[model samples]
Target: MDFPETVRWTFAGLACLTLAALVREIRRLRRAEPGGRARVRWDAADQGAGLVLTVGGALGSLHLFGAGLVLTGVVLGGKAVRAVRARRRTTVGRPST
Candidate 1:
């Protein structure tokens, strides 16, 4: 199916933003640790989210808009799962037992 010029430009803008966000997140993940340590560990979940966003952006750029939407769903689902887990953890710590 053919898309209009506006739709194409919109997808291109979204792709650019996604790529920028991915880069920012990766840099954040790679930040150094304290105590003169030149490195730090990273969370696999966060890394995976970054990867998903990157793939989504690439798909959008390549005109695979549907696939991009699917990947964006994946990224959102991951965030929701993480948020639920974090809430559960915090609530569990404050148990009335």
Candidate 2:
């Protein structure tokens, strides 16, 4: 494959892997009895996975629609960060149930 095609495919593969891991983690969390720490960790992982996939998708489609993907990813990432921060602030000093 050409260099650009190779790069796009590579990014696509990585994105798929990241998305799969995220799904697996979500399923595990749903099936098991998890503590607050575990839940928080999962939440963080979820956001990270989302970011990874978004970036990968943007890079993979660099020839077309890449700009839109990048923009969407940035917006989503920002929202996730803000949400996480707000959640942490609200949960501070509270007992985990």
Candidate 3:
């Protein structure tokens, strides 16, 4: 494979691995706390995965796969933003230790 194709596959593979890890974490949390209060906080890895997926999708040129990847990326990115906002909100009123 050429450079661009190789890069694309690499990104895609990384994104998939990130996604798999996220799913595993979620499942573990669910099992540990069946009440559903265990939330998955989106971190840097999630953000990076979303970004890679988004760019890869845009450059992929395959309609269906591209659309799916783009949509997943958007959702992941949005969730990460929301998680950050929520975290900030929780700490806003607390005095610095």
Best model per lDDT = 2
lDDT of 3 by residue, 1-97 (tens): 1237776777667667767676776566556644444244343335444555544543564554455566667667677777798899999999999
Q: After superposition, how far is residue 39 of candidate 2 from its true place, in Å?
A: 4.9
lDDT of each: 0.54, 0.60, 0.59
Candidate 2 error regions (>4 Å): 1-3, 36-97
Best by TM-score: 1
User: Candidate 3: misplaced stretches above 4 Å?
Assistant: 1-3, 34-38, 41-97
lDDT of 2 by residue, 1-97 (tens): 1347666676677667666776766666677665544555545465454545455554653433455455456656766886799799999979989
Please give the range of 10 consecutive residues that has the lowest summed lDDT in model 2: 60-69
> Which is superior by TM-score, 2 or 3?
2
Ordered by TM-score, highest first, the candidates read: 1, 2, 3
lDDT of 1 by residue, 9-31 (tens): 66557657656765665565567
lDDT computed for candidate 3: 0.59
Model 2's alpha-carbon lDDT is 0.60
In model 3, the Cα lDDT at residue 3 comes to 37
The total number of steric clashes, by the backbone 3 Å criterion, in model 3 comes to: 0
